[model samples]
Target: MATDGQILRLAQWLSPAYPVGAFAYSHGLESAVATGAVADGAALTDWLADILRFGAGRSDTIFLRAAYEAPPEDLPRIDALACAFQPSAERRTETTAQGAAFARVTAAVWPDDLPDFTYPVALGRAARLHDLPLGLTARLNLQAFLSNLVSAGIRLIPIGQTEGQRVLTALQPLCEEVAGLALTETLDDLAGTSFLADIASMTHETQYSRLFRT
Candidate 1:
């Protein structure tokens, strides 16, 4: 169990205003909206659910777990895998850019020497440095990711605030489920079958009049 101060630190790191610039990335949702793939609250919920179960959400959770548990010397392999795991250029940019920014800011404040890594890998290192529990870290990261997406959906899909909150509320159980699985899972078990989401990311790379970087 984490102490109260540990929990607060994790919360602060995962918060939306943490300087990670998460608001500038949609993880492909903007393209989904443009293509009419996610046009309403229900569609948005299903899209998010699929990703949580079988997309970046699952893979990132696994990566975070692996990095949190692995020795510092082994993190580079994990980082390399995370970079290669990105299927699209835009997707790659999304993770690496945020990861870089996250590492830069956290290292400056915490005085932990961090290697260049993707967001999940960087987060896992930060968790270890802060002595935060892995389960709590994973859960909070998932919630943050979901919240960022819902915020984007509010802008792109035009969903009302209440509807957006409902969508996030619906995903609470799944967030717990994914976090639990991530805690016990190994890197080899990582796989994401959210093909439509992957395609949307690829399509997002060429999307005209975009509001997000990915």
Candidate 2:
């Protein structure tokens, strides 16, 4: 179980106001919306579900878990794998940029020597460095990712705030389930199975009118 301070720290790190620049990236939902691939709340939920189960979300979970347990000497190799796993330039930029930004701020506040880490790698280091419980760390990170994506969906589609919240609420079980799986997974388990989501992220790069950097 997490203490109050641990919970607070994790919450602050994942908060929208944390300065990770998460708002600028929609995780490719913008392109999906533009192409009408995601037209409603149900579609949005299914899309995000696939992503949580088989896409970057799944990969990040493995990376996060591995980083949490990996020795300090192994982080670089892990970070390298994460960097190489990105399927597209924008996807790479999104993770690397956010990871770099996270490293910058946490360097001042949390003050770790995690050089050139991807977001999941950096987050794993932070979680371990701070001695946060692995279960809480996994669930919090997954929930934060889902929340950011849901916020994007609300803006891109006609989904109301309430509906978006509903989508998020519905995903909580899957989020925990993924988090649970990540606790036992290894980097070798890293696989992105949501081809459509990957394609949408690639397609987002050329979207004529775009609302997100990724």
Candidate 3:
């Protein structure tokens, strides 16, 4: 279980104001919107739900737990696997850059030796160092991840704020399921079957006019 202060720390780390530059990256959502694969709040919800269950959400949770449970000396191996799991150059940039930024900011404020690994790995290690509960950390991480993408959808789809919130609300159960499933899985199960999402990311790399980095 997590103490209130510990939970608050998780919220603080994943909050938009944390300066992870999350707003600048859409995780291929920009392309999905432009291509009309995600034109409305409902579509956005379904698309992001797939991503959470089969893509980065599932894999990152595994990596996060791997980092949390592993001997500290073995974190680099997990980080290597996380980096290698990315499907494209931009995808790699998205995770690694955010990871470095997250580690740098968190280390400065909390005074830890948090390494600049991929984002999930960095966050997992930080939560462990802070003595936060693993399940709560993973759950909130999934929520914050979905929340960020829904925010991106709000801007790209030009949906009303209420609709955006609704999309997020619709995703809550899926996030819970993925977070729960992730806790039961191991690194070997870190696989992504979201090929269309990966293609959207690759296509975004050369999109003529883009608003996101990946």
Best by lDDT: 1
Q: Give RMSD to native, each candidate.
A: 0.8, 0.8, 0.8
Q: What is the lDDT of residue 111 in candidate 1?
A: 77
Model 1 TM-score?
0.98
> Candidate 2 residues 94-131, lDDT tens each?
99999999889988886787665899999999889899
lDDT of each: 0.92, 0.91, 0.91
lDDT by residue for model 3 (95-165), tens: 99999999999999979999899999999999899999999999999998888898888889879899999
Worst 10 residues of 1 by lDDT: 107-116
Cα RMSD for candidate 1?
Answer: 0.8
Which wins on lDDT, candidate 1 or candidate 2?
1
**Tens digit of per-residue lDDT, candidate 1, span 52-170:** 99998889999999999899889999999999999899999989998998899898887788876999999998899888998899999999999999999999989999999999999
* lDDT at residue 211 of model 2 (Cα atoms): 80
Candidate 3 at residue 131, lDDT? 93
TM-scores of all candidate predictions against the true structure: 0.98, 0.98, 0.98
| Model 2 residue 87 distance off true place after TM-score fit, in angstroms | 0.9
